[model samples]
Target: MPGSTDEPTEPTPGKPSAADRAARVAAMRRTERARARRRRALVVAIPTVVVLGAAATVTAVLVNRPEPPSLDAVTTYEYAGGDHVSETVTYAENPPVGGQHDPVWLNCGVYDAPVRNENAVHSMEHGAVWITYRPDLPAEQVEELESAVAGETYTVLSPYPDLPSPVVLSAWNNQLAVESAADPRIDAFLAKFVQGAQTPEPGALCSNGVGTPTG
Candidate 1:
């Protein structure tokens, strides 16, 4: 018994065999690979989210900004009358070429007497007004026109019996001209008319053209 070695002992209960240990090591390696893949995905996802957020912020800043001012205000006029006597006048600032410009013209004169003496005057007289600034007109001109003509009355001419009368209102540097068969209260009509006359830019009432600024 002293010379004989103890019989080689069997592995303790539940202790893994060499092949089982190899399989456990392979399973651990697979778990680690899965964890590493998840880590790589998170890294890519974070940067992609950051880039999209930055792009959205930049787009909002560029698209919602205000535009710069590049246009000025211009003045307009209106005239009205009947068979008796027609007259014209200005509500705000008058243009330099009131009756002698390309777009502004005065067709005021007396016509031949009618066959019936009662309606014999057959007169045609009308007034005209407008505002103009050289291409370099100052911005203050707009304010000046508005202050000068805020509540003034101007003659409106309706040349023919079948034609409607014209209503005029001064707003900013522009004039609103409306034609109707009846007369409108000055204050009420002006409130609506001015809205159309006042534009943020300098140009014609209906179309864009050269003109002075109204405040």
Candidate 2:
């Protein structure tokens, strides 16, 4: 059929359709949303990692901390407190952990001469630990005993005429006999017995009492 001039329709070059523009806008929105979610997740993860790291450090410290050494060789005793006597009294233990004692307590320090049993026992009531060595102990060993208790208070060191062992450390209700001044138990006994749990009269005066200390 003959007709006026007509042509097929074609899309213009270098231009997008309305549907293509709408799809690109939707894709940009999805990408921006994904980035926003990643930023939020990163914010939450940073604090969580930091908290976990701090907790791990604290746990390691607790697990690695050392425990106190055990004191097993020390000998324990049981005695009542505050039994004062004016006359000389016999004791079950040679140094007397605790028993009838003079009202006056022997002052605490080293003594070249022998300390009276009654007075020393009184000092023990006041949380004093007495270390006695046999008179025949070597001068060097005696010096070692003194060194072991250096910078310490409430300790009595004296020479005993006849000791069952070379050295004897006696507290209120505890005692340890060591053959040498170098014995490790000496320090342990002092640590546990000076104003220790066994003290019958904890915090009593070791000074301002009877018999001046030689040292």
Candidate 3:
């Protein structure tokens, strides 16, 4: 039996070897981990891409939007107020543009009642725009004016019982009189002169002023 020449053969495999199985298991785990990493990357990347794209779109829209045209036809005056006088000062303009005015400025807001001219003049000195309309103006027109001035800082609105024009917009040393509330120049005037260059005190405070609304 020892002399028999047949080489001892390796065991015939019935199943995969332990080492092979272990290698396959490890490979599968590695593949699953790679897939999970890709998924996480995609989750993070997708939202970031969406947000960046949205921001870019908004920026483009803002950049492409048209700017308001400059208004040059507005009436100009030279009423720079360097003095704060307590006495009533008569101004050339019905609602004075700028002059010796009360120390306190009227708070900027819409008013159904008339605001005192003296206090409003002080607001103008502090770079406010005063919008005065005739008391007899239509309610609808008044509402239009109110919407225009609402939420705008350094702006005031009140009925001016008697006005040379139906509507008057006054800033420091500048005034614009419009015949109707629907006038297109109303917006132009405000855009040009609300806290505009003509203000004697360019950045003065318009809030916490002395006047209140009187209906």
Candidate 4:
């Protein structure tokens, strides 16, 4: 046959050329790399956000929490008896500040009944804050008083039949009397007087004392 100049035929319509296949694979790899990077970024970012959120929550709690009462308004009294006494004694204040007290310390807990005066006075010498409410006080107020003393290492809650005020917070040489059990001053008194500077005996035990647990 006579020769004429002619171009080669193309491959099948659906078949890709080698160069096109290579380009497409490279593009797919780029897309995959991009997606992988995004996944990793999310993995790192999620925990960071959670941690930040938790920190913010904790900060808000600390900021919003109520502060304890102040002790500046508490009245100071003088008493002489750093020593323990086995005999009955009388205190100038209805709830003795510091005077003859039982040899043992009263346990730290809520009390439904009145505690012995002499023993309680002894606990004051050992750096305990005695919180006494009138026996006739409303149960709700008593609960509030109990809340004040709960979980405190050097604090006691009890009922006094004839407390001058509805509630009296007594530490060694210091006394604060409030007519309300929910008085903010009660917290203040405990904050300052529990293991306070006025304590005649610091680091004395509040538990394992002579008194039985009052339910």
Question: Among these predicted structures, which one has the highest lDDT?
Answer: 2
Q: All models: lDDT?
A: 0.27, 0.74, 0.70, 0.69
Superposing every Cα of model 1 onto the true structure, what RMSD results?
Answer: 37.8
- How far out, in Å, is residue 196 in model 2? 0.6
Candidate 2 achieves a global lDDT of 0.74
Point out the worst 10-residue segment of candidate 1 by lDDT. Answer: 116-125
- Supply candidate 3's per-residue lDDT for 105: 78
* Ranking of all predicted structures according to lDDT, beginning with the best and ending with the worst: 2, 3, 4, 1
For model 3 the local lDDT of residue 188 reads 57
TM-score to native of every candidate shown: 0.17, 0.70, 0.65, 0.65
For model 3, the superposed segments whose C-alpha errors exceed 4 Å read 1-72, 213-215
Which lDDT tens digits does candidate 2 get at residues 1-215?
A: 37957778675564444344334434443433444466332222122234655653212211122222245666788789888999999888877788889999998888899989999999999988899999999997887777666655688999998788899989887888889976755655665567765778888898988777766
Candidate 3 local Cα displacement, residue 44, angstroms: 36
Against the correct fold, how does model 2 do in TM-score?
0.70
Q: Please give the lDDT score for candidate 4.
A: 0.69
Off by over 4 Å in 4: 1-70
**Deviation of model 3 at 170, angstroms:** 0.5
lDDT of 3 at 88: 80
**Which digits, one per residue and each the tens of the lDDT, describe model 4 over residues 115-160?**
8888788788888888888888998677666655555667778888
lDDT for model 1: 0.27
